[model samples]
Target: MVTAALALCVRTGAGAVIAATVFLTVLSVTLGGSVLADTPLWLPAMPAWPLTATGARLPVALVLGALLLTVSTGLAHRELSRAASR
Candidate 1:
């Protein structure tokens, strides 16, 4: 997704960024994972605080969020570099 957005931006302009941002925001809000239950898909899940009110799942959320952000950042960085080069 990041790569596609970067490619589009490189080819086009900031519109790609807005479109991609909207798409990702929608995707995350609609399809984001939940740590409260086990999902069949490997996609990240938003954590359910009701199930983990004791703060046990806080670490899980933090770790997963960090991991997801790290991966996204790396991919975005690579794509941005590629876009900048062109």
Candidate 2:
């Protein structure tokens, strides 16, 4: 899901958003795994959100990210197509 968002964002030339999404996704995965492993690292414990709540948040974030990327891509594609016609 995150990967699809990243790809769409990159396709739209939104470097900042793409970078942010990539960073967050990596951080989320790393932290999630570390927490699950019960590592003694000083990192903060994952928040106590319920499983269903956490699950719900993920799809929302992914959808929002995808929408932003899709809009950006559409705009970029329109510009490129227009330019090509000139």
Measured by TM-score, how close is model 1 to the native structure?
Answer: 0.45
Cα lDDT of model 1 by residue, 19-73, tens digit: 7677655645554434424342224333332233235656766676677667766
lDDT of each: 0.55, 0.49
lDDT of 2 by residue, 13-35 (tens): 57766676667556555654555
Q: Which parts of model 1 are misplaced by more than 4 Å?
A: 1-54
- Which prediction has the highest lDDT against the true structure? 1
TM-score against native, each model: 0.45, 0.34
Off by over 4 Å in 2: 1-56
- Model 1 global lDDT (CA atoms, 0 to 1): 0.55
Scanning candidate 2 in windows of ten residues, the lowest lDDT window is 41-50
